[model samples]
Target: MKQWLHLSAVAVFLTLLSVFPVLAQEEDEIDLSQIMKAAEKKSLSGGGFLEFQPSLIGLNRDSFFYQLNFGDQGPKRVGQYDFRVRLEGSYEKRTVGLYFTGDGLLRKGFQGWDSRARLFEGYLSLRLNPRFTLDAGKKTTKWGKGYAWNPVAFVDRPKDPEDLLEALEGFYVVSADITRSFQGPLKTLAFTPVLLPVLENLNSSFGKPGHLNFAGKVYFLLWNTDIDFLFLTGESRTTRFGFDFSRNLKSNLEIHAEWAWLTDLERIETSQDGRLSTTVSDEMSALVGLRYLTASETNFIAEYYHNGAGFGQRESEAIFEQAKSPSAVPGSRTGNSADAVFPPLLGIPNPMRDYLYFRTSQKEPFDILYFTPEFTSIFNLDDGSCQLIPGLTYSPQTNLLMRLRGIFLVGSEHTEFGEKQSNYRVEFRVRYFF
Candidate 1:
């Protein structure tokens, strides 16, 4: 933390030096009285966002949320969902930056802190020519490009409390990314090879393992189709590799897949005889999605993600039956006993998990790992809101933005809610963007 402070101090000082050329100006024009005012107006800026949110739980449990957004230029909106703001500047090979983005819900936590601030991302990136991009900040991991890829929900609104808590923490990510990029009119492709160095404050386990990784990707546009491919190799000692591909199908539908192969991967393998061996198993996965526009007034999408090792999950709220009989609720006996307590009066917990949760190579760019089960809503199709997202956006009077959506995921008779095999959600939002 102290190091970052020093770095920020040095950056601020250099910013003044670089932005203001006292040397280039006439000596007589250097007025001490106006120095501070000049920097204040030209080099300083600030902005913030505001929002309101309320939810009615279908399982009809404890469902209530109020959120706000206050930041300098934030995240990009997904149609009308989210936004991000990032500040970037460079001096020679060095750079100074601060960027943050959040969802529509802005809930405060203990001591008036923003709930998203705990893991909201902030980082400094340094590029040494075309060979490497070194970064250190509150970095989100580069996991499989599934729904669960992001850890910071400050700008990404999640529906469930369980999903909110599983979000990743802000860690000091120090990574060296070496890349070759190509951007053109006809088609473009770039391949990046990354290596993560040591990170002092990583959001990992007490005995978190370090990692080595090798990954590259390509992109092409043939005909009217857009194609993207990503491949990665990772390890603590042994190694694992992942591959992903996405392509537009027919015009209204899309398809994408993710796969991971473990190579004798081992964190720590110890036997009763004290002999040690490290082994990593291989895994495969595929995600298929289709979206159709029916008469423009009604549109729907269907997405399915399957893991060979049964380790894929979608983010959604976990409802606790208000217990008509009190004792029927099983209160604290539930999993993650501490989670039973109610949320802070003003702050909210999302309770959503990864769309395909897996964040590896903590604290560094080389931190590569496999996916984990979030046990969220995507697990169900007919009953859960994840597998199917059907909604419509309308302009009631051209000045108003209105949208209505229904999400359904079918739960298993033996999983999620055990005997409860159904859950559903309906969301309606109106926005006046001026």
Candidate 2:
């Protein structure tokens, strides 16, 4: 049954590829800054454009059990998920472009995730003046120059998305680049999302207002390099402040690093140890990495994320219990189980602050609840052009990532039985535009 479904998906994908040319124009050079002149042409007529992308992939993993007091532990099989699909697009515009994006999985079985969605991007902009412009709606507000979240490579876009979304919502922003003329391309944008009545859910069937989100950015460009420094604050107990720096090395080699301080917990409480904490342990996070693409489109990347694991009271009693009575509780967990691909390093500190051999992974698409039109500004996210997800992508220009993929979850080793409960996902998509 799974194989049949996969085949059906492939057939649908092929059909879309066969008609891309008829439905959308290929990438063309359009001077957005000069569009006002184009508008003056009496023969002007509006025409739209589009870009479609698709990909497939497979994954598998298993966990192992170990006892520190006893000795060496044995490996245990744990998780796995297979199947794929990721879609993204942009429509033609005389000035600023219109865009949106969605990416996730097409699961093969219960172990596989059914699907995940992301609003990615949606918004509109018109340069109101040379130094400023008004932007409204959903859009990505980026900041910083780091890997845990910065725009850099491809295998997947080398940036994070969750942090990006928190930075751009119901957007209204103004920007200025005093250095653009003398120091090359550099800009600074300062703005905040519109303030409206707060509601319970931003993502809902009825569509109600959510919490207030405010953010700002300073973008610097020099010799093909991009640096985005940001500040963001939002409701739902969220506050993301970080920096993302990415350097494009000759269009083939790329590198990046990131650092964020997230300490806006709504409440505080004592843990089982009776230790009341005012601050979330290591509210700070960091990552660093590099990427290189060969002539054949083959790519290579090595990245790392240190989530600073100083969550006080994280001193687990599992190993202690196992030593006293391994049978008292089989495969006990003192540290709670979650995906290991992006494990949290909550307490580690960097005295030297050197960003070598340590960085965060764009291990997964940061969110699972997102839906928006393909041409809206809320969906141009590609993981590459995001602030938090560190990813790498590759395309020979022929395939255009038709071979790319979505999230990398499902199978991974688990020392506990609870992890086996990784549930299946559901997917449904309805799309149209005016």
Candidate 3:
């Protein structure tokens, strides 16, 4: 039954692709404005992208992560191939709308071939009036103002620093949006409330099972500034409250910040002697950033983040020591659990106290149309480690894009970036949009 359903979905997707060009041609021959107006009331649109990436990675065999992952003996270099497909569509009929995004990936790596498929987002929305809307199903409520990091995104997954703008997989949720407009200093006001349930087979990765989480966000646009206050509370996780704001200082300069405070957050740490300890305390996380566009079309972004819940330098070094210990066992009581050590270090990127992010991108440099060059740096203030990335992007055609990039990790021993499994990597990617 599942196989038949999958095949039927593929057939429908192909039919939509085949129909789009015909509809485009017909619209070009008619009154486009009138057609557009009518189509807005009842429309179905679908599009997505295909991408291929090849990467060469240089291993850091002496690092703790390398030993934990590959054991004593590991390769010096690895070649990997990655292929991805995204299929997204939306259907709207008056006040009712349906939207979905599906992703599929195939990877050829040192471990051999692997493939996976996922529905990143599939949601149904209802607009009762111009000012109120409701949504149910899997959705991403991107509520933070930070670009590289969003400490205040209480209901959303953490963003990947390397791919900050990438679409994230969302959790099952029931949510609503209410908006109001004013004529005075406060021009706009909006509120969003979300209810998320975690069950044995649904949204299990979110937190503890059998709990319903409640979260909400209130927005205010006042005096040309955008501000938001948000909170989350439930049995699944600690209660937290946060706020974010964004403002344009000038035509070419903008600034944003996010702050979150978590009450009684639980943290686990490992001692150098391989003893595990847990702590519960109040914690705060914050990020402040700015974006500046120069006259030469060079865009610069800088951010500073302080993660009060993260491990300090000494704590991180102890964890590294535990991972490197030859006698470390998963189930041992005296020694730290191998399971606990690896997940905190590898699963969470930049699990340190302080960080600095800087990125600069030049658009169409030297009059080379559709070509851009960029550089990014993420520095760990606590451990004095950093990752540097330089890349170039070019769009040779309207539907195609090419990107080439190199990533290098720099740090001394016992530092965050220095102990990464990979010392450096180079990758080339090609993507096509439908």
Candidate 4:
């Protein structure tokens, strides 16, 4: 099956290559003036992508997550296929505009075929002036300075560390943006404020229902530095204050940082003997990162993250021990037991107290246009566990992309990465836009 998938991908690549010349030839015969006139008159536009991804996973049946999720019927290895379709459209009339984006996925895994559909983003906006705008409906406010992790993204959903660039589902909200341009050291200033309401069956996943939440961000471009001050308050979640900054130290080097403080943040811990406990206190999380580009077009990124809400090494070890034990019950465990406590602790991207992330990518090596190879690693500073990912991406033609990647988890028993279901995974993805 894996060989077939590889051959199929190769066939598609060749087909696209053959069609590219013909498409280019046809493009040269088009009238540029007519195209421009049509573009000026067209107010509605739509585009999206269809993606196919096949993966092979080497499972660790003895891992804590594997044991809890698959129980006694777990498989040692698995092959999975995924198909995804994303559609996005926008319509503009004068100062008013409407935008929507939706996606659907079909997957065949060890369990069987499964499907899901969701609206990722949908919003209406009114431009009051050149520097002011208002929007309402479901939207994503991607705020933060960190690349892999966003410690100060108080108003947005948590990012997937493995795929930090993937689009995420948005929350319902009303928001406004006001901007002002300056003439001196301060180049620009912007203010964004949002009101998010959580009611029955609407934005219920964000926090406690039946409450209104308020969040805002103040941005400034001063002395060649990008800075932001953020805040969130209300009944749905804990009130939080955040600050983030980004600046370029040189033409090829940049630095960024984020810090957030949450009031009355909750922390949960499990004991080695299967006992659980919870505490509430103010928490602080911070991240510092840098990006650099070398003369040879090689890009590098490194980050250090401190997760105040994450578990301690001892707590994580206790949870894993309980999960590996045969006497642990699956369904009857409560908040005070390790069986029920491991899910939330292990499900997060980085559930440990401290982490270090590094990534390097070489662009268009050997003069191969639109081709890149990258390597990334996330090290758990607390438990000495780590994940290594290496990938190659190629774009043979416009609006088409292909990527092949591998993931390897390394750790000892009772460590974070060692408790994952899959020790390694290999995947290939082909995506085409229309």
Candidate 5:
């Protein structure tokens, strides 16, 4: 039954793509003035996307994460299906606006069926004037200028490096934005301040309960360069200060950098003998990146990131060795304790001290309109581990998209990627907006 459902979905996707050109041609003939009028008259608007994705993964039986997760009863290969729907709506009245977005997801894999639903963002905004606006409820700050990583996004949730553009869940906060424009070398300036409160059953995932967090950002557009200074402090987490800048060196080349200082951050480490230890110290993290576009319309982005809070090479090796020990039993008391200490170091995105990211994409290759083929790589400099992803995306018609991608993990023993549960994965995604 599951196989049949998968085949049916593929057939439907192919049918839609095959007939999209005809539908698009008809849409292009619609009168633009009428569409504009419709938009102008609408104060309430809603739209969302429905997605279907199927994935195949090849497992690595010798990997540490695999043993920790499915020690004895795991499969060598796994096939999975996922479905997701996202809905966003907005209502505007003169100076006040309300916006909400939510998503639901369902997945079936080697384990079983799993499903979840949550509100990604829902906020109310009041614009006092052209220069100032206040917002309340749940929202995402989306700070920083880096394409893959944002070291200075202190108030926003961390982005997944594997799918950097995917929307992330937001936090509950009250915030405000104030802006100023000028004609001199400083073209624009803006300030944003945010307050986040954590309590039981609300934002418990963020940090410790019963704490109010404060964060802010000041931005300046000076000499055609974008600069920002940001800070976050509260009892829920350690205090941090960050700075970031971005500028274009040439018509086709741009550069960006971010630096952050964390005060008295805490970390936990496990030894080869399964003993856990904790350490606290001040740390600094930084990232530098560049984007270049060639004459052929191929775009390239590369970045080097240093994560001060991540595990060192020796620390990672010890953890991997512990997993490989014959007496190690996942879910046992010892394993549970080790697991608690591992995520802060090993479970985060780019969970290593030093890493490199590179991506390139060609737009509309071979005169194929609305199509792009891209390749991305994230390399861990500390352990020589890396992930390579090659993908193709196509927009057959307005608000309709399709993507196919493959992920390959490469690493040696005791390396970051080498100990992952899967060595390779292939996935296909289709989404339709309405």
Candidate 6:
């Protein structure tokens, strides 16, 4: 009787062991299904980053722009601190979607404490089908094929050569995209049309006030090469036509180009005696570039740019000469006389006519992971001035990044880079993403 009882107990235990795994697996499947369904039904998602940047700026006290803007009395070197936060979110439901990206910045610099907030992008997108879509609100069109310079970016803001990949502020516009696929050398075609309005306190910086702008782009993928034809016209800005192309000659080598023609564009100049002058003429701007990647994880980029609308050698010299005059002093003239003459020279990046860009980056040297070092040089072919930047980026862990870089200017007196506010600058940046 005792032996029978023991055998029955062992059988009962074995039966429970077999049943438990099946029950647990079914429960796990149900939980996983719920989680996946919840994810699919989620209508809103968001992520952003926090950044801190500090810089040590080496002032060029004897420089033309420094003397004109800060006068003779200023620090030789100064420290600046910056804090930034970015918030981006997206909502999607069926054929409609909404997205927004906002940025806030606080800084303590030579001008003292300052803070500002901006909506980088906010738009509503309606996708009627895979081939047709519409977008309305502030957004970046991001046209052109050049990496460092985009003379053909008619509907977008200019790119900073030093930070070519950085996000830019957008213009409010209504736009549509129509796309089609083909089975030949011309594999794909797309058309984008944009309507941008410049009103008081709305997209006012885009151009003159009270005008609606029209722009369009036609894109084609012919023989595996990308090409685009673009145009913009309105009362706010002069009419312009643009063309851009990008092609890959090899798996590791790529080439790109951009060309723009503007009608009745304006160029401002200053005379030796502090007289301001303006010129209106037709202009053509262009850029050509190439990118190559080597087997050792090294990338090289080169570009040549011609700015037909930029200041000439004589014009730039005259402006620099005027900057040395007494009236160019910060408070020498009453009621902002200096504002009219200096804004053009100081505000625009690379205001000269001819330039060359060269850059190289090496990834993960010496078997180190998540590290990259880069060097960049921007040369002023007209003035013989140049700027050199060396930088390093490292990520020790996920969602965290650190970067350090230095910028040094090389030029003689009476040159474009020689008149910069800072001859050298070193900065460190840290970012955390969530």
Collision count of model 6: 0
Full-model lDDT for every candidate: 0.38, 0.37, 0.89, 0.90, 0.89, 0.88
Model 1 misplaced stretches (Cα beyond 4 Å) = 1-48, 58-98, 101-116, 127-134, 141-171, 175-187, 196-201, 205-238, 249-254, 263-280, 290-300, 311-329, 333-413, 417-434
What lDDT tens digits, residue by residue, belong to model 6 across residues 1-434? 99999999999878876877666466554566877875775789998999999999998887766765677787899999999999999999999999999999999998899999999999999999989999999999999998788898888888887778778889999999999999989999999999999999889988999999999999999999999999999988999998999999999999999999999988876567656688799999999999999999799999999998898777777777665665555524333333466675656899889999999999999988999999999999988999999999999899999999999988877788887878999999999998
Regions of model 2 farther than 4 Å from truth: 1-108, 111-120, 127-133, 140-181, 184-198, 203-210, 222-225, 238-240, 248-254, 264-282, 292-299, 309-434
Give residue 218's lDDT in candidate 5 (0 to 100). 96
Please provide TM-scores, in order, for all candidate models, with all chains considered together.
Answer: 0.47, 0.43, 0.88, 0.89, 0.89, 0.89
What is the Cα-based TM-score of model 1?
0.47
lDDT of 1 at 382: 22
Lowest-lDDT window of 10 residues in candidate 6? 330-339
Cα lDDT tens digits, model 2, 180-282, are 3344454333333322223555423212246554455555565556655555555533555666667876687888777666554322334566443344432
Superposing all C-alpha atoms, what RMSD in Å does each candidate have to the true structure? 19.3, 17.8, 13.3, 12.3, 13.0, 4.9
> Which candidate should be chosen as best, given lDDT against the real structure?
4
Write one digit per residue (lDDT tens) for candidate 4, span 240-325.
Answer: 99899999999999999999998998887765555757889999999999999999999999999999999888888776766556
Pick by lDDT: 1 or 6, better one: 6
Model 5, residue 207: distance off in Å is 1.8
Q: What is the Cα root-mean-square deviation between model 2 and the actual structure? A: 17.8
- What lDDT is obtained when candidate 3 is compared to the true structure? 0.89
- Runs in model 5 lying further than 4 Å from the true structure: 1-32, 268-276, 331-337
Candidate with more favorable, higher lDDT: 1 or 4:
4
Per-residue C-alpha lDDT of model 3 across residues 243-345, encoded as one tens digit per residue: 9999999999999999999999877666666565778999999999999999999999999999888988877777766665666742243455444555755
